[model samples]
Target: MFSYCTDPDTLSGFSWLSCYLTTGKHMAFYRAFGTVLLLLAITAPTALAFGFCGARAARSQVAPLRWFGKIYIAIVRGVPDIAFFLFFVIALDQAFEWLRHQVKCPDWDEPIRQGNDFVVCQIAKMPLGNAPQWVHETYGFFLAILTFAIVFGAFAANILYGAMNTVPHAQMETAEAYGMNRKQAFWRVMVPQMWVYALPGLSNLWMVLIKATPLLFLLGVEDIVYWARELGGSKTARFSDYPHPDWRMWYFLALLVFYLGFTKVSEVVLDRLMTRLTRGQATMGGEAQRKAAA
Candidate 1:
């Protein structure tokens, strides 16, 4: 990255370190941190939306819808995350390609599964083989996002379903007494109040989501952990410009600090949010806030 980076052999101490850190690979390593943050930003809301739908479905008057929601929560929450991540990404990718193959390769007689291989026409590839590197990366990242959402959403649904029930039945009755319909009472009364109950669980889920970002590596997204291992692996002068001993421990220590700091910040923010949500409400948290104020 620097003009002096032309000669890594002569550079030493801080000078060598600066150039090494500013190399193209290092830039990518830096961007990997953003990738992790971006995953969290997008996945959190998407999962929440999925959870909301699932929670609502679980509580639906229609038995089929309620059953579907309960089954979704049960199955997803029951699965181990690593197993699900491994299975789901391949299954979802193949499902997409299979659907596309049916449309794009209708004339072909070959079955998609040839013992162990999933073969589809070139055109049916998720990101066509000829597509840019970014397209492939984006597609993988999208799969990662979807996988994260599905897994986390089920847990969120369970938390939300419980939270919804925790909201007093009398509150719903009061809304009905005021001539509001069931839907209106749910939206205007129960949903608004459930957040206070859900926040603690959601807060923990957010932290878990943060920790789970490393699983992106398994999905083939070049996440921070991937870059850390790549960059920190011992590089010899024979093969590369920046030759260094194995620094993975140091790299991982940096990651440890980053996650710790990120979670700490999340905790502070969630705590303040909890306090705000509880103020003037009827829960124990609200009561405590009131007592403290008095």
Candidate 2:
């Protein structure tokens, strides 16, 4: 905070507002935007990896693998995304601690689950009780990313699985006729064409993912929404550098603009990507490109 912030009551106009927005807490608030971006950066690729694995498994010749893949897609899709987010974070957290407890406190005889409380031996805590604050925050961020990956992975798998099916069987047969092995045919022939089909669904999923970033608050991460509430709430002289009336509506309006601008930019990028992927493919997009060039 500025020197003026030392006496918020005495300051007015831009001086007061500047001091208020630069408080230590407000700095944290500003950093929360980065938290959102970091989550997306880490989660998107992890989610894509998960989806790719699930899609490949679903198409595997092994019956067990196929069944497992199908079940994963079904269970995740059947539940509401928000419900899954709430449920999985808890389940996964407990699961990690439970496994740790088994390893770390095998000799302990007390029940881990008693009433509403879950007690694990001190060493079994995910970060251990003595772990630093940064460790705790990092662990929580990891779980949030995993939860997002699991949920969005299912959606991506469905899109990719359908895309795989949409690839012409004749193309596969032609690859075989040319003496290409199944794996070679898949990598060289099927994968390329599948993108032409997958991009639209993947684009929609990307938009949904952007919209869902606010759920980071539910995961207990101090995301942008969390900061918006903390900084925008009415502050009293007793609790703030520059006390002000509630301005949460204005804060949320800014968020609205941020998302709308981001999504529009994403649309433009995805459109360009679609055009590039569709080029020279036997699709309507390619046809249009050829006619335009003519």
lDDT of 1: 0.93
Segments of candidate 2 deviating more than 4 angstroms: 1-7
Taking all chains together, each candidate's TM-score versus the true structure is: 0.95, 0.95
Winner by lDDT: 1
Clashes of each: 0, 0
Candidate with top TM-score is 1
Candidate 2 structure quality by residue, lDDT tens digits, 1-294 = 556567767888888779877888879887888888888889888888899889999999999999989987787755678999999899999999999999989999999999999999999999888889999999999999999999999888988999999998899999999999999999999997898899999999899999999999999988889889988899887876577899999989988998999899999999999989988988888999999999
What's the CA error at residue 1 for candidate 1, in Å? 3.2
Error of 2 at 153 (Å): 0.3
Off by over 4 Å in 1: 106-108
